[model samples]
Target: MSQTLGPTIAIDLDMLQTARERAETRGESLGKVVLDMVRKSLALRAPVPEYRNGIKRLPWRNFTRKVSIEDVNVLLNEPE
Candidate 1:
């Protein structure tokens, strides 16, 4: 049986050259090199957690204090 292949993607000349150099250096095919890079990038990405319900609080959740122009200047260490 014939195997199915992925669709062809168009890349810029510079990017293609870079991938070719990488593939030559690693003694691997350009397709394999690019696939490896894509896999590595995907692996490094943070997985999205499933949210059950309600609002999600971020790291800067407690920084809800109101600030005036003087407060902003003070925070920036700028003179009035």
Candidate 2:
């Protein structure tokens, strides 16, 4: 709520409320919570998911193909 010249961004009400609660619980300012979250997100890499009867693959490029629900089911449910 400052009129000072500074970069500003809008946050959703629900997310803001959650962040505020987190800040209160941690005895830190909301700014600190946001900054920590941003830093952690920037440090994260693509997560590898375990597939049934399949090896994990990554560094996918030009992979524009979309998978349907049936395809997802097939991948999820492997023959016993």
Candidate 3:
């Protein structure tokens, strides 16, 4: 199916430069890189489904995990 193009949007010079760099790194067009980034960001902002594997999961499950200072210190000490 053919998709309709959206209205023109203006971006700052820094944003334009970042998009160009991402395009070069991924060997994709600037438009494709920008669209992919937008899609990813939108997905993050969208609400997640409640049910998974017949279990009711919380929308904030990922963020609700407990993390202690010891865990952070252990991660920091891990050899790369």
Residues 1-80, model 3: lDDT tens digits: 87667779898899899999999998998889888878988888756567989998865656666899999999999999
Which one wins by TM-score: 1 or 2? Answer: 1
Q: After superposition, how far is residue 2 of candidate 1 from its true place, in Å?
A: 13
- Separately for all candidates shown, the number of backbone clashes (residues 3 or more apart, or on different chains) is 0, 0, 0
lDDT of 2 by residue, 49-68 (tens): 75656876555568578779
Model 3 TM-score, 2 decimals:
0.48
Candidate 1 vs. true structure, TM-score? 0.49
lDDT of candidate 1 over 1-80, digit per residue (tens) = 87568889998898789889999998998988888877887899755554446655443446667778998778799655
Stretches of candidate 1 above 4 Å error?
1-6, 49-53, 59-80
> Which residue pairs show collisions in model 2?
none
Candidate 2 wrongly placed segments (more than 4 Å): 1-6, 47-80
Greater-lDDT candidate between 1 and 2: 2
The C-alpha stretches of model 3 lying farther than 4 A from their native spots are 1-6, 46-80
